[model samples]
Target: MLKRCGRRYIVGAIRTYAKDIRFGPEARGLLLKGVDIMANAVSATLGPRGRNVLIEQLMISPRITKDGITVANNVQLEDRRCNMGAQLLRQTTSNTNNEVGDGTTTATILAKGMASQGLEVIRQGQVNVHALREGMLEASRVVCEELQSMSQIVETIGEVEAVATIALNGDKRLSDMIGDAILKLGEGGVFLLKESKCLNDELKVQEGVTLPEGFVSPLFANQGNGNRVEYSNVLLLATLANIERLDEILPALELAKSKEQPLLIIANDISADVVKALVMNQLRNCLRVCAVKAPSHGSEQRDQMQDLALAMGANLLENATGLSAIEAEDLGVVSEVIVDSSSTHLLHPRIHNEDQVHARVQHIRALMEEAITDEEVDKLNERMGRLFGYLATIYVGGANELEVSEKKDRLNDALHAVHGAISDGIVPGGGTAYLRCIPALESLAPSETPEHQIGRDIVRNSLRLPCYTIARNAGVNPDEVIRQVLEGSGNFGYDAAAGQFCDLKERGIVDPTGALRSAMSEAAGIASLLATTEVLITEERIRPKVPRNQVTKDLAGLIGM
Candidate 1:
């Protein structure tokens, strides 16, 4: 199947095949090699104080950032192994981002570490694949629990401040501003700022209170133009009136008049007679009037109403019946009436004071808190849980801050697969699910098993490429770094039977430096778990190619072609 594809295609097919197969050591090694290639590229930019860089290649130039998502999306790689490895790293990053809205780098490193150590156990014949997987699962659980337990409470203003502080540590002012905005808005209203606009100084508050330009009507106008009317001693209505009932309208108006309030009937619609009666009553009692329309009916109308309400006021009443009249009565005002057509009956509005407003705020806050808490608990209890998925990470430590920063961007691109998985909840065992599959690989290995040997070789060889790259950059011999990595694992590269490095390619051996080791570990784990997983690969339908005519004198000037 691979041979007919030609050399480049075959290599590509093999690269994909290695990621898709889940048996023995050779497959594991290939997978690991891919992972390491990607991880090492990112490890350099892991710290909080990391800076940014500019990456200029022949075809593209990207202003590099330490942000995991940014980096993961930008880096370029040609080798099939590198590409696959990078993909796994990306998946881990995505997983982290989706789950926590942060922590892609952390997950990437964790997966890398598990894969690296799991392979060693396989080589040592101390544990089978199943045991290794169990260990990984246990480790993941421990890690996730630790994270969740760390400052889970975000109740007080101080706690919220602390969250903003950590999230925007580099720019204390930005954090301070967010904290301040939250404080100013109190608990009821959310402080919504686009991520990009968070730091912009031109932001304006346009909702809630706006000073009247002149002698403006107390009634807040609905978006529609024709549905205008006036009121005095305004009974503010907050509901959709979609029903047709003289019975409903009459009672609500009577209640308003009992309070001596002039009703500003805000509703979806009112009968012509109902409107004329309200106008007549206002003139008879010397009452002023104002009326605003409610949103239309149906899903779109509901959505618009919600949006309008949210933008205009912090508190909203769900039932829009006779509440307007009730509120006017409380305020010791004259008749105020409100009507809603959708309701079975009309309701009197209740005027809310500062105390009522504060209560409403607290209610909203409690609701949000309850929701978050419930979600957190549910996530913890799931079979996969928050911690069981990809926790692989790559930590890049470097003396040159800029170089390290640049590598972070590259590494993130490589880990896109993991990142995405974390964002969108994963299927039990899918692509990038290998982070939880290390134990399965270990189980397949045995004492003196060729599979085990292949896994080790793959891991070791994978690390060599990055080690050499780093060594060369640092003005050291690539071979020296490669040897150091092997020695650190209690292994020697000088095997007479393998004929040194001459037959490494033939024997499926490669350099196993730290980067390669980590990458391979992650890739192998992902492959083991997700290899049999099938995806509904959607092929974009090809559009008919349009032929371009050669530019004539007339066209050349117009197009500047």
Candidate 2:
């Protein structure tokens, strides 16, 4: 029996702990085993013909789906060590999703295969882990270049629609809608998800939707006036909602009236006095400015408002800057605004692109390349996202909640797939993109050089896993697909649906190279990290709180207690 005293481990008549408790080989073996177990668990859910995994829950009904990322996420392990290994492997998959927004399955399979092969080679005692990583790094670089070279442009609407169709399992309706939305928005569009209130069971695409920052007080509620209100030619303000400044907005309100346009006062705040003044103006037929607090607050709120100013060609009222902040040119044109007690909706039907938006994108990219830190890079990415200028919302309509839920998932997948294609072009999907990378890596096989040989073996095997798993999952023999694909010259491979050789591109099966690049980078990163992991350390589970009287006093002999 083992006992612990004050964070120390004791085996016999000792009250101490060993510092270097290394289960080096065992730990590594478990890493490989754990990752392999997870990969195999999801590998069966890889292709079009891949079967659904029935994940049963305690008391609840089981879930059935062929989504690889979903399967990986729901993976469970009874053993503690295996669970830890699975968790570490999961980081790669998670990163793939967050970064590239697709290819979680391929990433998982690659990471596990790399870990397994490298572990086996090192276990033979002929080579070190560094050699494996060096080869993998080179192999990964070549693979990336090959993928980029193989990519076909997503220029036409139909081609882009192919990407979404394949990702959505040939749902042409959703795919077409997504494709058209991307084309209409011109690549800088964000996705806004919402439920539909229409009679028909369908998905509707709205050009743009503004996120309301916060709601106004109930006193300003248009109660019984329905929830939607339309405002035009709004005076957009960025100052705090101060009642004392009620008179400050009079000039802009009057200017809009003279121009024969409705006044839309988008302010940071609407003090009680200002609200009353606007209401009185409406009653007296002077001018009715639909007052709404700007959608967001603080630094983020300010930035968003500023972006709106840029998009709408409106001027932001900066009281801190000067009194001149409320110029006539600063007023913006908003298509409509839906005001309510809970929130406000600002809609811009037309997506007007400023020439500076394109310039800003290029500038942001250059700054990103020169960034010195992770923080800087992230900030630049955020800025780039803002420059996109608009977010397109897909209002999904369903007869019930479950149908809506299912449609939302499919729509999301289609959107991400379409987004990735637009961002980085695309490569042949159904595992062919990953499959094609093997020959490039195979060239590095060093027969006589054991150190390099270990690395080569790890990469070559790992490089094939995605294709292999995909084929195997589709009920086709992996060995046959590998031979056929290797025999062909161009980008052609086994058709998962027919279980025969065909052009994947012709079949409308392809994946985003951006997503592929992200998946590969993450896969390589996780494999390299696992290769260098010398030990797995876990703290012992703490016991329940001890009673003070029952506790072993440290100064027992001195105090005779």
Candidate 3:
């Protein structure tokens, strides 16, 4: 019995801890292979003349895109080790995306180049891997500082369009619309992109607030062809009360139904069964109603709802009793309401209580003046924006669904780039900003060790990869372009589209300094990790069981039966 138990224990241990392990050069080489494969695919779409990748999708038509993150997300490898490496690279791209919302392509190439070069150095021996990683990390910080100092503020609408145009892949119309929207909305503005039936894109700017909380249920979006629940001349009921049963708000619903007016309910909470009943009633045309949970919580929720109530000239219901006692005259009127799953927009036709609105604005400004922390200041600014902000929606038009998807992807990237620029500023573009940092990076620091120097060298050398890839994609000799850019000083870089050396900033070609900084820093950190890694462990792939009949047929075929 002891022997049997021992055997069972051994089997269970094996099943529990089964993993495929790799070590040393073999592991690093396989990882580099993965980095190469993914980087190569994404690098093709690096410049103005860059090529689009056609991606095969399941349950939908294939998508053709020039977006780097989209390409990286679709990569899957047959080899587990390679897939692990690919996934690591994907992390780099994702980090860059989350940090800056653009420059995923640049980040991918930088990570691949840094990892590959670092591996080659490791193969050459003599350097401490830990020291090398430390050096790279330090070098990344220095480069970011240099880029920050080199960045110029985007102070003009033309400059904004220039940055947008590059990110949008030379779409002037889209860039123009985005620039106009940015200019009109100013700082802390909110805008949305929507698909348009027309072949030409359209833009609409309005004065309103876009709340983070959207419709409580999608069924409330029945009025529109898309997911948006839109209403004209709607009545709004704002309350801090939680609706536990349908009877809680049945009177208000009946009032709206009798008045033949659309009603929007902003409450603290509504039970699932209550939401279901509301949805069903709307679907059956029993009532024209939509429900959304009020934005924020506690005191914040009260303040926002009060601000909204003030704007709508409605009574602020503080408890369940007020909600139950709601009347037709108690509901506030709004010119329009647009809601999606993620956000809600309320537009007032005109300020109902103009003096009260002004007083509220002044009170918020006073609070801002007395604010002690950055968070407080930000919250006040957001409240101010909500009260008097411009909400713009860009209706993206395309020839078909595929074109629309691709265009929307590009537009989102551009929008993010614009935001990055606004927050941090803009720097030289087309890899020029990275290439210019090599000299400073290569300069030896006073306390740098030999291994640190080698590591720093690896990063500085790898920095040239973006420019080289862009030139190669543009069908130019990358070496000559690099040499020329190095010889020229101060914002001089190769224009892959124009195939000549010119002033990048003068040509209106630039990248968000924040995006480039994020790309370089994230790439350096990940590549250093990959370089120091000596062990790779992954789940052992299990083979599916074959049926006895299929196995027998295979054996008979082997015997020529």
Q: Best lDDT goes to which candidate?
A: 3
**Model 2, stretches more than 4 Å misplaced?**
1-22, 54-64, 194-201, 208-238, 257-261, 296-303, 318-325, 334-390, 395-410, 442-448, 541-561
* C-alpha TM-score for every candidate: 0.46, 0.78, 0.72
lDDT by residue (1-561, candidate 2, tens digit) is 234463353342242232323477888876677787888887776766766676755445555656667678877675556677787788888788766667777888888878777776667775667766777766777788888988878878887888888767666787877766777777765565667886343434443334444334333334356444545444443444343466677667667777777666666666777777777776576764566677655875676666656665565666634333456666666676556655555566234357755775677668756676646654555455455645455778876654565566566666777878987899988777877777777665455656656665666677677778778877768888877887875658777777778887877778899888887878887887788777876543333333366344444433333
Residue pairs with colliding backbones in model 3 are: none
Model 2 — which ten-residue stretch has the worst lDDT?
A: 12-21
What's the lDDT of the predicted structure labeled candidate 2? 0.67
- The residue-by-residue lDDT of candidate 1 on 1-561, one tens digit each, is 465657888676555544333344554455566656655555444432334435554434435565655566555465443355567667776554443434444345555654655555464654445544443443333323322222122344443433333233233444344445445544322322221212233223222221111112322232135233333444443456542555665555665556665544445665666556555655565444444455346753443443333322323344435433334222222122222222111122223244543453454434443444434422222211101111111234444544455544333332322222222322111011122233333344343544444444333233234334333433445575455444432122221222232322222221112122233334445533422222222122233333466545446544332
TM-score for candidate 1, please give it. Answer: 0.46
The predictions' CA RMSDs to the true structure, in order, are: 15.9, 7.7, 9.5
Q: Model 1 RMSD to the real structure?
A: 15.9
Each prediction's Cα lDDT score?
A: 0.39, 0.67, 0.85
**Model 3 agreement with the true structure over 266-363: per-residue lDDT tens digits:** 99999999999999988998888899999999898888888888777788898888878887667888888999999988886333677887798889
For model 1 the local lDDT of residue 435 reads 21
